[model samples]
Each structure stands twice: as C-alpha cells, then as structure tokens.
Target: MSNEHFSLQAEIAELENILRTIPEEKAISRLSFESRLEEARSRLAELGEPVVKEKLQLTFRGQPVDGTSGILADFGGKAVEVFSSAVSTVMASINGDIGERGPVAKKDADKLMITGTAVGSFGFELEVAGNSNPLFEEDDVTAGGVVEIIQDLLETAATGTDDEITEVVDVIHPRALKKVSEFLGFLESQKASCGISFKGKSFKFSNNSQLSNAALKLKDQNVKERPVEFEGKFVGFLPHSRMFEFSIRETGEIIKGKIGSKKIDIEQLSDNFLKAPVGVTLNSVSVGEGKPKYTLTSASDIRAKAGGGSQPPLTQE
Candidate 1:
C-alpha cells in the first residue's frame, strides 16, 4: 500500500506538470491531461493520501467588482457569505451521497481551501480536499463528485425542463437544496453574474431570472409539517441506501423510511436493536396518494422492559 501510494503521488505530480504546460486554447489536450491528472489524484486519495480533488475558478462580474483597488467592501462581505454557503452546500451533499442524512456537522463540513486568483475577473481558485478514509470506503463520494452534482444542478436549473430540474434537486440533501437556493438568490439580488469552472467545463449565471422559480421549488421541498414518533421493532437497515424497516407494535404494521442520523453504529444497531423494541421519530412528507415519505430523525432502544435493565437504552440522532 505504501509503495502504491507513493507511486500514485509521483504520477499525479507528473500529470500536473504536463497539464500546466498545456495551453488553455488547446481544449482537447487540456481536457485529456486534466482527466489523467484527476484519475491519478483519485487513486492517491483512495490510498488515504490527502489530494486536491477539485479545483474551481469562481469569477464574479458586476459593478461591485469594477474598480482598480479590488471588490467593494459591502459586496465582499456578501461574497464571502456566498462562497462559504457554497462550500456548506457541497459538504451537505457529500453527507447525503455517503448515505448520511440531516445537517452536516461542523467538523465534517470543511471549507474548500483558497488557492490563488483568476486573471481577468475578481475571483479565486477553490481547492477541495479529499481522502479515502476507512469510514468512507463503502459509499465514498469525493469532492470532485460533489462538484459535478453542483454543476449539473446549476445547468439543469438554467436550461433543463421542470421535471429534469426537480429530479436533480430531489437527489440533493435537503439542507444543501436550501443553501444553493440562497446562493442563487444572492446572485440575483446583487444583479451580479458569476462563473464556476472546473477543468474544461464552465458554467455561467447571468440574466437567469428563471432561477427564482428554482429557488421557490427548493424552499417548498424543505417544508416539513412536524415529526411523529412511533414505537416499533427495528427490523433491518441498508447502509448504502440509508433506508430502514420497522414493525409497529400497536397495529402490527410495517413502515420503511430514510434514516437521517449519522451517529448510528450499524453493528451496534444490528446486534442490539434488530427485532428489539425501539422508538423511532420520523418526519413525514405527503405525496398526494398512498403512504407519505418518512425520514427517521431519531431512534432509541426500548428493550429494558424485557430483562435488559443492565444497559441503558442506546439513542442516536
């Protein structure tokens, strides 16, 4: 593993050198080089080495940035908020991609590191850090993957059909959906345009007033009425899908839903709670017909009544 790690690192260094030599006007050559570079870095990261997985050039264009000194102070503060919010959006989506739901923890939502500036526009290059930790071995979605989703969602919002936009938004973490909505709202409010570029692909947001519709759609999705708790037996859980099954104690009914807690220990849950009496709190969303969609918010073991008094109930959120 050590040898392979170093070898991958060396390969990545060489690829970066070749990529730097490639002219941006040579689109095909630059793309090929960048592809190879990203592949090498991904491999290195998978070996537990920290790698710069995604590089984005964020360029802001508007009267706020039209000056010889730099960006306006008032706009700069809002711009900082916009940049941080974008990173948080990516972090929340990463959690969702890895089958973890709910808001991202501060420790888990590391910001993209700034790395130099763009030439013409007042902008900076944001570098996303990556590593293949053991915890992420199963459903690892690197920073690059998250960036691709952002690009796709933005592209869809700008041009795709309503159904297409909804489809993409549905997959995003609910928290991220809200953040990106705010991100777009900030852009619209300032009447400023911005561009995000990764490798050969670039997306620009200008007079896209239709983004208001997308923002409304996102806000609507985040509206949850209230949480309802149920007493049941923990039947099963699928880690990759973040889905769980429960058998209700009251009516002998079976319910399945998405799990929203990252603190759950799969092994402990299987050993201690499976087929055991438990309490589940869920947030339900109505879908028009049939059963509503459920998201499990918190759960607790309630097996103490059946000779399990020695151990305190394990609860997680």
Candidate 2:
C-alpha cells in the first residue's frame, strides 16, 4: 500500500496560488490581493474536507511503514498553542520541545502534535469521518506512558542495581523481561479488537469480552499462558484504521506453544494486522521451528484515489 504522507503547508500554499487565479469577478481592475485571498479560501476548503476514503495498514517497528495514506487535520488552535507552550516549559524535556515538524516530505505532510522525538500513537487520521481533529492529548498520554516506562527501564539498566532492574520491569513491562522490550500493544487496552479462531471461521469482539463457547473453543487442558508479544513496533491495527499507541499489554496470545515454550521459532512468522479503515498489514518475524505465521487476510474499503488532476493549493473560507 502507498502512504499518503504529504507536505501540508506547502500543499496549502500551492492550493492558494491556484485559487487566487480563479477570476471571481468578470472584469476586476487588479484584484491581486483578492485573488490571493480566494486561492487560500479554496485550498482551505479542500484541506478542511474529510477524507472520502482511507486505507490503513500496520507495519512492524524497524520495518518501513506499509501505507503512508491518511487524512490531515489542523492543530492550529489557541488551546493547542497555549498548552503546547506550557507543555514545553513544564515538561522541560527534549521530547516536549515541539514547535512544528516542518517539511517532513516534499509532498506536503501534515504538522500534527507529537513529542519532538517520538512517533506518538497517531498517524494523521484522514478526515474519513469528515474533518475531525486527531485525539491529541488523550492518545499522547498513552504514548507518553509507554515512553516513560521504557525510558525508566533504559535508565535502570544504565546505572541501577539488579533489584532495580527487576522492579522497573515489573512496573513497566512485566511480560517482556529482557533489558529492552521492542513494542507494546498500541493503546493501553484497545479501542477496537477482534479475535478470530479456527482460521477465521469465527470471531470475538473485545468490547463484549465474550466469545461463542461453541466457536472453536481453546482446549483449556492444552492451553497455557506462557507469554505473548508483538514484533518490534508491530502492533495490530484494524483494516484502514489509525495506528494506536497502546494495546492490551496485560494479555496477548502465545499461539502454537505449550506451557514451557514461549518463543516463535519461524524464520518468517507473519501475523495479520488490522488498522480498521480498510487495508491489510504484512509483517515478518524470526524464522525457526514452531514460529507462527501471520497474514493480513482482509482490507478496508475506504480510500481516495491519488493523482486526481490536482491543481495548485487553494484554501476555503
């Protein structure tokens, strides 16, 4: 899938230029200023519109993001500015020093809020639902929590006792006990979750937290909770949905393993990733015996085709 990361400000600038030449008046003497204004308004109209469709996909950490396609939103509000500044001062950390990420790509990527150095949970949720702001602080909180935990762990390893190491591990990542943990599930719990068993014959909803007892039940006698984890940054995203910052770290699955076996030995274990909006994610893990294979069996149906005879940027009032 293709990513939609574009240069937003630049795009807006271009749109403004195009709209300015629209010739609103039949015989205007010299409406250079008016033309410019009209251009901005036209571009703003385009930008302000929600994404007609979006195709979301999840890619594991260390791996290239599959699709960069997504919606864009404006965070240039008074509240955002005030809090952003205050946050910079109060946090006093390198992470919080975000003014704006200028010109990520020449194609006009957006300037959303995030810790300066971290890839926060959000990935510009395209206005697929009409122009809506990305849940900035709420989502960032979870991302920040994970970062804090990992940061603590790294610190512990640097200059702490063995006891401290264990302590930090328990608090932050009790599951992955290594000196480092790759990635936790995005979202502390999960906004949306679907569990499928028997190769997708049946599915379970995380919201209801109940499964059809008769639908391919797990044999409790053989079932064992060894440990579960995702590949580096490889959190599950429903089809076409936005990637989340946290997931149910407390419970995941240890597929195809006994009580003592807690490692996927497949040379290329692949698992399906759902980001919801409509798109499938493909990930590959280590290779070995008993390594589980993953495949994003489905995709979403929401996406606006690229390469519509795009004129220069323009804004709407």
Candidate 3:
C-alpha cells in the first residue's frame, strides 16, 4: 500500500479505538461521536479511490455551463452524494439552504443520478438534477456538471449579466431568493468598498492596511487601471520622503513607491543594503497619463540578493 493509504488506515484505527474507549458518562453527544466516525470513514474511502482531477464541463440546453471547475479529490465513487454535497456547500455559503433534495439514484457502481425541483429565496423554483459516471475508469461523468449547475446559479446571482440574473431568479425558489439577493448585495458592497474601478470590476486589496488605504485614495478618481501583484527588487530608498523605488522582475517596470504617512518606517526595511527582492501588491495602475503610475499597497517577503547597484532616479513623464 502507498504511504498515504497506510497513514489513513492508521488514523482510522486510532479514531476507532478512541470511539470505543469513550466513557458512557462522557459520551453525552452521540451526534458528535457519529460525526467524527463518519469523517474518518470518508477519509478511509478516499485512500484507494481514483480521484477526478480534470475540470468538469456541463452543458445545459446546448450551451456550455460556467461555474467553478477543478479537481474534487476522492468522491467515494458516488455521483449523487458528491453532487448533493457540492451544491449544498455552495448554497450554504450564501445562506441559502437546500431542503429535501434527494433520493440519489445509483445506477450500478458506475452511475448515480438525481432529479428534483429546488426552492430558493423569493419563491424561485429550479429543476435540480443531473447524472454522472462515478467510476473513474469511465470516460463519461456528469458529476461535475451537476455540481456546476448549482454553482452557475450562484455565480449568476453573484455577478452575472442582467439577462443571466433574471433567468436565475426565474428558476430560484422563492424561499432561497432572499438569501441569494442578500449574497449578491454583499458581493456588490465588497466591490464598492475597494474604491479602485476598471471595466466595471473593482480592485481587491492586499492584507496590508496602510498600503490598501493609500491605494484606495490614489485610485478613487474616474481613471482606468489594472490591479496586479508581483515580486520586485527594492533598488532605491528616499529617506527624506520615505519613498522607495522598485523594479518589477517580470515586467521591468520601475515603480516609484510611497509608504502611507503612518507607515513611514517601511522604507527602512532591513540593514542589508544589497538588492532586496520583495513582493509588491499594486492596488491599481493608470496608464492614460504619461508613464503608468503604479499604486502600490504593500511590500513583503523581502529577501537580499548577493550583489547591489545604484538604480537611476525615477522620472515623471
């Protein structure tokens, strides 16, 4: 057996032993015990099973479906269960619940299926169903498709075209529309809070609060800019102004970086005066005026290279 399989077996054995030894007085929560046991069994099931790694594509009414597509590890060779779980997770994330949605049909060990109507906020109703080949050996599997349907629905509610949103609402059950609507509003609010806008999409902020605030102020205007993050070298530091210069490794773009007033010490970095490679998270870039002005929000993971040389002074276009 593989090391991963052996490790899973050992873990299962340990969990089983613990379950057996629990005192009756302390085992007040049978539900908790059962939950842990179920989790252990699921892991055990995953050990020897062939997993789905390719992106799952599902077509609805001739058009390709759009949703989150990626590997789903080991699905226990059960299509319906996998689909149900995937749908439930996506729905629950937006506070929408899936009520009474199964009886998952297992057509032999290779295929499992489910077909039903689902209700969401605002009395919206949609047909929730699809089939897939559970056996990894099979060339056909709609498990991803089934999951994609629900995912696409959520995505539509989150950030889809007006037509897409209307179509999704028509199918969503009334009970779930409120939650989905709220979720959509939440996404919109998040985008607005970012302050930088381009092509109807808002820029996302990095973890650094100081830099993020500076970026927000710099890009608050009605200019178009692309947000990007990359690693670069800290080639110069202006101690008086507390500004630094960075040469982006990938694009060779030299950026004049300034720390927030509250973050003046950022230019000091470390004593090492050599080439300092740092990760730069730019909030936005405006290229309409002269040279592109890159609004940097954060710099981290600074590492020193062997050699160092003086970089040319930054010039305005």
What are the root-mean-square deviations of the candidates from the true structure over C-alphas? 11.7, 22.4, 19.6
Residue 315, model 1: lDDT of: 46
Instruction: Flag clash pairs in model 1.
Output: none
The global C-alpha lDDT for each of the candidates, from Candidate 1 onward, is 0.63, 0.27, 0.39
Ranking by TM-score: 1, 3, 2
Where model 3 places Cα greater than 4 Å from the true spot, the runs are 1-222, 251-253, 270-274, 287-290, 299-317
lDDT of 3 by residue, 1-317 (tens): 34676677777787677777776577565557667778877877866453332232221110111122321222212222433344443333222223425332332322323222112111111233233223422332343443454445544433444445444333333334433333323323333111121122323223234222322222224123455666767677766655667788889977775542333244345334325665556544331232334443333324344453223222222
Per-residue accuracy of model 2 over 33-119 as CA lDDT, tens digit each: 556556656665565533322222111111122223321223212222332232222222222222223321110112224322112
lDDT of 2 at 224: 23
* Per-candidate total of colliding backbone pairs: 0, 70, 19
Candidate closest to the true structure, highest lDDT: 1
Estimate the lDDT of model 1. Answer: 0.63
| TM-score: model 1 vs. ground truth | 0.54
Q: Looking at model 1, which ten-residue stretch has the lowest summed lDDT? A: 301-310
lDDT of 2: 0.27
